[model samples]
Target: MELACAFLARNRMEEYELLRVFFDSKVVREGLSELQIPSPLGRDVGGFQEQWAGPLCLDGILAGLIVNGGAYKRYRGPARDAKVLAGAAVEALTQNRFEDFRVDVSHVAWAPWFANVAWDHTYILTDTANAEITVLCITDTD
Candidate 1:
């Protein structure tokens, strides 16, 4: 896996297809080298974003490496603020009978960091540092 990663970094973008052929079958199905077929424009570019370090190394490697997972980056949040004990509250917050709700966010925190709050109702986040909250409704069940 490390060699595959280094090869990607060392080779030209035009050569990615070659590497795809050598990857595991599961990887191929999950949009590794080729795109799906039989529909609108056939498919889209689905594979590693070369610039993102996380997916690049953690994709096939790091299953049991490092601590739990192989994470190689910097986190600069207050230690306590990063700890989230609000899974139940978060689930309740996005619960919907007619919608498949999901939390498409990270680095999230409630207004009062490390303090107890009714996560089921509301929580403040630093998305964009001073961003507006946007709610999206899904119409598909994939």
Candidate 2:
């Protein structure tokens, strides 16, 4: 949850509460379309799967967010620290449980509030060893 908190902090989403839900990996893998989880478009996991033609690299995602060649470049230190923390969280979550995994990011067009305009990010991490699915969803203004 620290990664979620870091994301919220970075995006200044303190006013809103993030909802974290855990599901059994087996159920998610077997019948994602039938899962009762609330989705942005009322669509199934297949909708998000269609967004990317290939898997997203987690390190690339973190690296791209760093501010470079500007006054904000100095902030890269904190950004690096944040990346380390996020990486630790991911390692802790997937360690010993994953034999193989893939990362994908997708966005949806709906939000709980009228003022919140986007489903800014949805990161799906799938552990292929046993079909475990770990999703980190961030629905905030980017």
Candidate 3:
């Protein structure tokens, strides 16, 4: 995940997109494949889909930071959970104590990659000096 963060820090957007796709595919293939299934008599289990479970506010913050010109890089690191990191970041940002960084005004709430259950925690870091942002995601399995 540090590699991903470096790529984003360098503003290599295309490579970052490719990396994100690769990670997302891996999560879907490996993570979702572990789901338990019970046998049924000639029953077909179709239309299976995985989604990130979270509220809209966090999702919007992530999108604005990454997609809408905020230029946030992602870094995976240790944490208890994503919710905790997000809540802290949100509170700090809301209270004007988030290291002088401001949230983008555009509203968007769909970031499937952030919902990947493979990660347990995520942190967004910003370098005010260089105007760079990094996101750190943590997990025990990896």
- Candidate topping TM-score: 2
Best by lDDT: 2
RMSD value for candidate 3 = 15.1
TM-score for all predictions? 0.21, 0.46, 0.25
Candidate 3 per-residue C-alpha lDDT over 29-119 given as tens digits, one digit per residue, 9 for 90 to 100: 3643432222221111221111122222554444433332212334344333444565666565444334433222211112333333333
Q: Cα RMSD (Å) per model?
A: 19.2, 12.8, 15.1
Better of 2 and 3 by TM-score: 2
Q: After TM-score superposition, what is the CA distance of residue 119 in candidate 3 from its true location, in Å?
A: 24
Please give the CA lDDT of all the candidate structures: 0.26, 0.44, 0.36
Q: Which scores better on TM-score, 1 or 3?
A: 3
Question: Which segments of model 2 are wrong by more than 4 Å?
Answer: 1-46, 49-56, 60-77, 96-99, 110-119
Write candidate 1's Cα lDDT for 1-142 as tens digits.
3343344445443364422332223543354222222122211122322223322222122122112221234335443333332322333333321122112211212112212221211111111221222221111111
lDDT of 1: 0.26
Model 2 local distance difference test score:
0.44
**Cα lDDT of model 2 by residue, 3-119, tens digit:** 444444344222332222223234443554333444442323323442232233464454434323222233446566756755666676567343355554556533332123333
